[model samples]
Target: MTTSQRWISTAINHALLLGAIELEQTDRGTRPHRLPAAARAQWPDPQLLMVEGQPSGMRLAFRTTATAIELETIPTKRIYVGMPPRPDGVYDLLIDGQLARQGSVSGGDSLTINMSTGSATHERGAPGVLSFEGLPAGDKTIEIWLPHDETTELVDLRTNAPVEPIGTNGAPVWLHHGSSISHGSNATHPTGTWPAVAATAAGVSLINLGFGGSAIVDPFVARTIRDARADLISIKLGINVVNTDAMRLRAFGPAVHGFLDTIREGHKTTPILLMSPIYCPIHEDTPGPTAPDFVDGKLSFKASGDPAEIAMGKLTLNVIRDTLSKIVTQRAATDSNIHYLDGRDLYGEVDSAALPLPDRLHPDGDTHRLMGERFAALAFAPGGALAH
Candidate 1:
């Protein structure tokens, strides 16, 4: 029997939205956000705008009896100015908490970004439709994970049966924040990101604040984390601080303290895990201002700052790790709920040898899986850092 379909707008009441702090309704459609409007207004850097626009941990989840469904979206794909063309961002379909299909939209607008110049150009394209046919009958949970790397605008949703949002029902909420590594940079799909994988393993709802090239210990971001409703909070810091050369040793400690202080205001006794950076061979001993090298149009990062700058207090991965360890230790002495996890425990030298970072910065899909599994084992496992 051919059931009639009805189009529905993407509204908060109709679908469960995770990780996003706000929704920007535009002529194109509604765009989910990780940072609130106030934060965006404060730091209107184009890089922050671009990274936040990408739905790192956003998904549209609902319960439906539909046998067939279609969703229209306008994906703003990013193209690094000099790099080769990249594949379309993937959309993941999950039914009853299992991945059912992986697909990509054929047409969409493009955001051409010049990393060196920190400028962007937009190229218009048509909206793309994603269709799923022959879904299981009866009430079933449906989740469509947005592409982690693209700025996606929800256009419309169509289904043959009625749909409604599903409530959390007391599920533990895990709020996470980090750098591009946690933003699903080189992951295979949206759920394949390390944080997503860990969240699934831990059986907790996730709110990921990982932003590509934008997790620079911003006060507004800390405030965002402070205000979020999370039972468990974990922050993976330091990579972006080194990559952008955003701060020196003099300011790094105080900045981290302030960020933590802000989060502690809302989550007084909530379990907070402070994680250092993962193993990055290039930035381990070398200072950064990471520079990209395009070899045959392939993107790879290299440490551009001098190693000698360490004496001058220029931050490096090692410096950040030491500082984070000290800070967590000092705080844990006063606060039992706070803990520390060395990111090397998640992805260290041995793991890197087995599953190396493809871009000299972000982990590959395999590494993401490994890191996610490892993180779950360490933090969520019994007697672990974040374990209650």
Candidate 2:
């Protein structure tokens, strides 16, 4: 280490961490997890385990007078064996609450998955450093948003000047839960995610629980949200359930009710917005187990289940949306704090025409920004459901 540089222990610097529900000590450092250890212990699905550890909305917040800063981290990057390589997760640095610079680390570890075979292999590599220099003079609040799509283990924080925990800005905390789109699929960086964008615009603190492919209204997830310290809560449903064919119509309604019931037990009268899935042509009326389509070496998705199955209670995006709307409406009769939002309002047919989903599933970076802006306008506006 340089004589002028000092190392900050991430393990002991708990107050500097944000958006993570738990932090587990690792051999090299500490790994931030969106879900608490108790929830993780209940369900051991590999997909859920992986996505929950991705640290979608996690970041480090501190006040420092440093001109140069370096964060040492080991990130686990995921790759699909047959498909094109995914981009390295990007780290966003914010100075005084505005984006100042973006950076990324290379050569940490890789987890290659064979989607067709449902098997994955992990290879370890040395940690890399993300360095930022030439900050504006004087003390300033700094936020280093971690990669939204990668599992990063933070080793140490090095700076040329002293650093201290940043105090909260007195904004309401918005706890959001949803599928991969909300987890930042295809988004260029962590702050680009819709939840982050909306949170920033609405001036609310964000606690994102959007697990990729794992937002199936699990009881454990509901319990976690139930126990969280949130001033406002929003749960986006339907897409993952339809795409995974994880539930039939008969079970979907009760599962959602149960999920809300569990949360209400702890957060009585807390503003809760229940949202449907955004427009996705492939699953709007058709049922899924969506399967990957490799047409001309380009990745896309196709609904593998028969549309006729909907008559027999098979769940489709349309069905799930209708059910969710009805569920929220029913709950609102007694619980005035509960409300419903049609996801189509955020991203509908016009949006689909303008900026199509790049993979016939997830939206691209631009779309995420659009969605975030729309959400902020709708939810934070006067007389809006989430308006104080």
- Model 1 has a clash total of 0
RMSD of each: 1.8, 1.5
For residue 152, what is the lDDT in candidate 2?
Answer: 90
Q: Estimate, for each residue in 30-105, the C-alpha lDDT of model 1 and write its tens digit.
A: 7788889999999899888888888887777789888887888888877887677888888899999899988888
Pick by TM-score: which candidate is best?
2
Stretches of candidate 1 exceeding 4 Å from the true structure? 1-15
Clashes of each: 0, 0
lDDT of 2 by residue, 304-361 (tens): 9998999999998889888999998899899999999999988999999999998899
Score candidate 2 by TM-score against the native: 0.97
TM-score for each prediction? 0.95, 0.97
Per-candidate local distance difference test: 0.87, 0.90
